[model samples]
Target: MKNVIFLIIFLFCLNSYSQEFKNITIIKSDKTEIKTLGTFVYEDDLIKGIKTKKNNLLISFQDVNKVFINKETYLVKNYKFKKYLFLKIINGNLSLYKDKKNYYLENNELGLKNIKKDEKRLQFVFKTGEVSLFINKCKAATNELYNKRKSLILSNLKKIINIYNTCDTSSKIQFADEVIKESNRPKEKVKFGLSFGLMKLKTDYNQPFSIEGSDKNFTFVGGKVYIFSNIFQEKLDANLSIDYFFRKNYQINDIDYYIKNSTQFTKLTIGANYTINNISKLITPYFGISGGLLLSSNSSVKLISKYLDLPSRHYTLSNELIYNINVGSYIYLLNQKIDLIFEYQPKINTKLSDSINLHNNSSSFSSLSFKLSYIF
Candidate 1:
């Protein structure tokens, strides 16, 4: 829970305070162009830059020929008996457009038509025949794509739309070559992987200690999921991981196995990672910090003295959370589809200390770890 709060605060800081479009271009029906470098709000098919232009600043749907926001071009078109700003994505004899989350196709000869939106962005979520059948009005386009009926999806949806807009032989040949290159483009994806590492624990003793045989060194296993991101830049990302380990210490050369301490814990780590440089490179270095909960079968352990025959004593639950630092390098393989990772954590959490042990200023439990992971 602490980890979640920290992540939320970090993202909240990165996002801009407002969603305003500036330096946006607008073309009137009269063919006059205006470049409004001032901040403007767009909503309800109107550009609310209302100002001292004496009635020229407030822009309505009927007044625009086209509006440009960077490379995107939006035109005021009619949809469902109402005026709307639609982004034209493909232009040919038959044109394709997007209005918000929906897509519409239009042509002078053929009436406006809507395309069924099943945009999951999955690699192959839909079949070509499914889309071709939906837009059967374009027989030439369908016949050309009928051969690869099974490969149609959001990633290649543009290619199909481009082919439909141009039924000519030259355009068809051009799209065929373009589709091959599109396959290599990188996309935002969630990658899964596993990691195994060794944990090293240290104890700071202020005075003489009685209990012994605590396993200071142990191994832990974990799995991680990485979500590719461009939060601030291209290589920035966020990931989640879980790890489990067991540690115990006992007194030896005694009749009874006097256990000093025993703990089996599982932790959840939520964090962000930023690659040092371009991710396409052979060796990509990255660093991150994560904070999360520590769940243990036994947080406070009881110990009994054999020789003294004293009553059982219990340790206090100093802290119930965990956090760590991760610095790693990725060794890319098989065309960057796979990565072998090596990571080091200088600190897992401060002391993991409770108030009791810290109050007496006698003991401290701390750790540092190393891990190796395989991501594909």
Candidate 2:
């Protein structure tokens, strides 16, 4: 009875693990069907493939006539010995297709015949009666050939429009507009956001002078607004931000001498961030290094003069050039228009002045900040 119960539990776990993968159906050219239990995609080769628990399977582009995933069908179409996978039929005999190509380099170790590079291009297909037009990138083609391709595309598009007019003209205008918009949409290139949080000083000071009674932990409340531009489109970003910290006061006492001090720190940062641009995903993480100038000053100091009289004095700490490293993750919500970000940044100890230093007799300063940012 114990062995039977263990076997039943093992089977139950195996069934649950198998349910994690989606079912895929591949229809071959010979009218045979391959029913597989795994996720599949079109990778480097001109074929549709899947990685299964047992082994990887690659079906030739010519052999695969259709693929069915979750009741949705993808038709395999061939042009000039290259296969294109069309997702579904659009309005008035139009369809969306993905074109993939592999490029080989002459100096590559694998030789010129072996593919060393790959790219996927979005394509639109328009078909009417016996006419078909596939619109793709033609930047490298000659002007004459480019114009010819464009003319053919427009001509076929007109036929599709005429067919739509004869049928459902109610949705033609909206459908045509959607197709045009999708074809000409620009890629996302820039993002802007604002962040607010508290910054805490985490430096250990080897002070030449001592304060008899003082709080060692110094924290400042501040906010920053930043703009990020894609430097390498989806991989890296150039970041710029202006940070403003509110003024903070510290009271120091040294046995019969009392001092009142206040300070404000502002900085302008220029940095680069390596971002994983999975905007379509729920969470994205990034890390970066930045160098900036901290515009700082000591506002007013009240202390007892040598004559046993209290006096107020104003002094300035020189502007500081500092470097820092930051790590953060963005929680995307509401179609990525808004984000809740959590960040931890550690500032490297940089010298502020040759004379006076805040809290510490040493010239260097350091801070750790926790921030939350929203991006639109």
Candidate 3:
């Protein structure tokens, strides 16, 4: 009776252990499927199969059609001359898959030994009808390649989705093929734009020579033109710009003396801009910073020593450095090739030097600009 009880307990333990292993179904290339009880282990292009009461099996990825393990299905995919095991998340005409790829890096140590390390990265796979698209989720690569290709990937995905939604079963294959063809084509790397806008400038001078009363502030009208290039990515831009300001006049009065001045400021700037939002959309916002040379030309100040009784003294202001910070937006039209831009530059500061003494003086200003640009 005790022996019978032991045998029953042993059989029950065996049954429980078998239940712990998942059921895996492997579909072969010849339209045959095999059911195996094992724990599936995947390493690159091979799946290690540890079967019950059988020798371990090593299955080549190319010979396998699909794998069902742990109640989940994985499809074998080929991309960029590499094989990927994709976990199918959505099963329909258009499917989404989670993909994993293993990468090996070689390190040389002591000039004689080579060490190899493996890294696994996760990526996304989209299957539209019969077309497959791969999206990389790793940011380890340089921004140049990633930025240039990111928009292409998004555009292809959008096209694929649209085609899948509109096409019927008979025409789906043709549309999928078109999408694949378009996706495989090389995309544009560089985009160029030109901007022209109006600007307003207000100058504030500091301390020792602080103007009194209404003369403390001076406002001027200006116009600026800039040529900008999209570099590295769509969200970043490199710009070269020039600005011309109209003449502004001011009058200063002290108890014993009066002074009159007229000034015109011009600037040549080189800078960069970073867009905070979607660059491919109809409207995108950006912020920029620039540093340049400011030329204060036709600037003459006349000082009457005593109420027009003494001869007036004339002095000219010298050129100085101009630093600017601006916030702006781009409204895209004509398929994003043309844009209308509106920008508000709140802080533009420069230091004007005295031509005779080379003494530095501060000038602070602000401007609003409107420009039309073309992207190529």
Candidate 4:
């Protein structure tokens, strides 16, 4: 089959690309000549952190400068990170180096990094980010690589490094604008899910206004979508959410009301939630504020009094701005692909609306709400 042949070729390519650094020759950073350390094999335990004792020879990867294995060479350079092994592939005034995940360029004055093609594809921000590093020591070389092909591929990068190593001017590292912008920008994390909760509402819905029979105590099930991002700081995240709630009440009795009346309203809220992050990897506790602007509301009110019986009438309410305080946590599961979110909002001022042509122009209310959401 064609599938079997393709899989065989893929496995063969992977095996052919496997690198082995069995032997090591330690050279000091100060250009001192040391006796050759010939026999460091796979049995000696390579990559044992910074320091490792092997065959009575204590080798500290951080302290050493150059480590040569046969014809291949690895240079230890701590430009941005702590000392790590960088295999020097091309050597000169400008040299090309490669590690397990990234490729780097280093010269007398600067060391630049270019993330491997598959290392980072769609990430917006990270601790150490992907970048298209450039050197302007030679204008001709820079133009040829950047303008002619306009790519950040590995082959073009090698040409630029080779040409710049032979340049007559001073070499300095400069990151392109696109690389710098992407390094610091945090992309929005969007989540869509369903939320079901209850709201302990303090409203004037004594009896005259109760949509779906909910008076002071109400329950709501809604579809919520949230956009979360760590905008400014690592400890805080700025988030936005839109919720369409279906609020209803059940089990009505005559003993709780002064008059036989009920009122109900439907509303959609667009709100922001600012939360703390990284309390724990699995259970991240967050406490923040939720604020929103209500576009409008549709309310139906019915009053059945012994003296006066009134039919249910619909009222359209205007817009209002309100803010509430909440505390919550994000529970991550399945390698953080699924988030189980829980939020609790204490009693806060809930402005019903601007005008509804009702008994009151705009009534101020308070609500205690609890919502649980599952984000996939």
Candidate 5:
């Protein structure tokens, strides 16, 4: 009897470990369908799926109607056209989705409650008071839902918690895994980050013939792409980032006359960061610096209505180098996984130009950016 039991257990373990993901096809509408490639399993009141190939997961949308396939095996589920697909998770951790709207199952039944693009988050509850429904990947039905339905979600969640006396152990754990598998966000979380709403620069001297203060405009758009990892399971953290910026501007300075010019360039940089006392389940502050080469190319300038009307504009293609630094903090929003970020960058570099001393000089530029981020 012992030998037989051991053999049965081993086989079950082997089968679960060897589990292969099948593709899921959802008919969202007459014009749309969703294709998912992941490992899927069914349990009472729960559907668990994971994409080991991509390291992604999805849970919640507990109700499934059919499993079918065309040329390939697909786990097909049915949903109503305009009801919110609430993923009720009991207790589990998984990957986060960047756009909750995109994490939706294809069937019309399992969709965001609203059709508005700007709205993207809903709260769900599973175990009355013991466990609550939280979104790893957030999607809003519309801005209206965020503004109007906030109270309804809170009320419903609270009421559900008041009724259930015990946690649904099996469903809760299973749903959490499902949430992770169905997520569409990046697999890794970014740290010590920065994003620019807008960065502007300017420089000018007097025109040759007139005192028209030559005005120039330098606008930059860029952000840091990096990864952050926790150390000692808590107190310490690390951040690695890549910084790049694209700059372009136009200027008309002097009141006496007009001197117009525009230029465009691209810059790249890489850096790493370290944080202390970071694992406290609260806000953590961090600092870091990065240095890299800046590659810039200049676009021709036009001297229209000023000097020569023949070839009114002059164009030059050139490149340059630069250095960068950053300091920032991470604030928790929904929990440890969701965050709001703010950072500052002060850069020093030789201006991009084509052998013109008038355009060649070294200066420091400064900027501040705010970003909202979520981690899985």
Candidate 6:
């Protein structure tokens, strides 16, 4: 119902603003004068006005004083002056005479005027003479200009009315109402949270060692350490960890002798980790590759083989491979800034120069590493 009412009001406004032009008609002042004027032109026709030498009394359609015509002499007049216009219809020759001016209009189109030296007006006596007071040609010119102007106005009005009638007033009203409602609504403030924390790591590992003997022989022991991280930021991260020992023991087999050794060693490594998935908000599985130099100190061997007759001494191993590949998931305990993590990074490749062999020497050494990490 509201939409129908809106459309009706819109169409009504369109029709009311359409344009209208006045119809003009000319009427001669006197009946006798109309007969003498030959009745060639209607009184209501449009007329072109011409400026003359006289200021107050000029010649135009609606304002001519008198008209006179004879066989050879035709005359036109205003209030203060008169002009002579001579034409021979058969020969097509016209001659005009005023105060000091003379002009000829023959077969060519022409008109005449009486010049007043001081006044800025003239008596325009046209070729048709007396009735030149009513300039038919000038009237036609005026009608043409009038019609042109009317046509332009009519076209513009038609366009305006069409656009106005076709407008969607209901949509415009709805839009305005929405704008007002939004302007009256209140705005809310936003808040943000921030936090940070640190992580730690621990690991257990076994390694083989050698002691000086009458014959060359090797022994092995199991050792474990806890690693702690300095910093961690996800996506791209860097951390340094220290290995603290939990167990140290060495055992040898097939040597026909015995030697005691302490497998105690401290390892320091700088590693980078990349995390992939986080499940249940508690476990995050990450796979990362890292390579850096490692140093081990406090390594000692006791001769476990008496038949080999070996002595005990301290040996150092520096610049070992720290490349450990692992697939592991971390559990978040504190779950805020810290993650409790367990990872297994196995030595998939080898370090060529560090491997020792008596009969045949292989170029690589392999090992497995397990670490518990506290992620920040």
Model 1 per-residue lDDT tens digits across residues 225-329: 988864543477788888877665533332532435565667787988777875666788888777777675354444445666554444543445666777777
Error of 1 at 119 (Å): 43
Over 4 Å off, model 4 = 1-186, 205-215, 233-238, 247-264, 293-297, 308-319, 336-363
Residue 122, candidate 6: Cα error in Å is 92
> Model 4, range 1-376, lDDT digits (tens) per residue?
9999999999998765433213456777777644443333221222322222235454555557777767887777675555666778788877777765456666665565544454354532211222233355566565555443434456666676677667776546544443446567677666776666666655444333442333376666666666766464334555555544454433333332222323344335555544455767777776676666544354322233323353323333445566656677777777653333444333323233323344433334556777777675
Q: Worst lDDT window (10 residues) for model 3?
A: 106-115
lDDT of 5 by residue, 122-192 (tens): 44412221122232122221122223333434444333323332323223222333333435434455544
User: lDDT, candidate 5, residue 80?
Assistant: 45
Write one digit per residue (lDDT tens) for candidate 6, span 1-376.
9999999998888655332111222223452342221212212221123222224222444433333333232223221242222222122222223211322222123344322122222433222232222122333322332333323232332232233234432322122233345455443222121212121222211223332322111222222222323223233344445554433555444344454434344444555556675676887776655554444334433334455355332333334556555455556575443433333434332221222322211122344454444333
Question: CA shift at 149, candidate 1, in angstroms?
Answer: 43
Clashes of 1: 2
* Rank ordering of all candidates by TM-score, starting from the highest: 3, 2, 1, 4, 5, 6
Error of 3 at 221 (Å): 7.8
lDDT, candidate 6, at 359: 21
Candidate 2's C-alpha runs over 4 A off are: 1-188, 203-205, 211-233, 255-259, 276-280, 298-315, 336-362
Of 3 and 5, the candidate ahead on lDDT is 3
> Scored by CA lDDT, what does every candidate get?
0.59, 0.50, 0.52, 0.53, 0.40, 0.35
Give, for candidate 6, the lowest lDDT window spanning 10 residues: 190-199
TM-score, candidate number 4 = 0.39
Which regions of candidate 3 are displaced past 4 Å? Answer: 1-19, 22-46, 53-200, 210-241, 253-259, 270-290, 302-314, 329-376
Model 2 per-residue lDDT tens digits across residues 237-326: 566667677777776656544555566778777776677656547776778877787787643344434344543333345577777787
Which window of ten consecutive residues has the lowest lDDT sum in model 1? 45-54
- What's the CA error at residue 18 for candidate 3, in Å? 5.4
Tens digits of per-residue lDDT for model 3, 243-271: 56667687777766566768776767777
Candidate RMSDs in Å, in order, are 17.6, 15.6, 11.5, 16.9, 22.3, 33.1
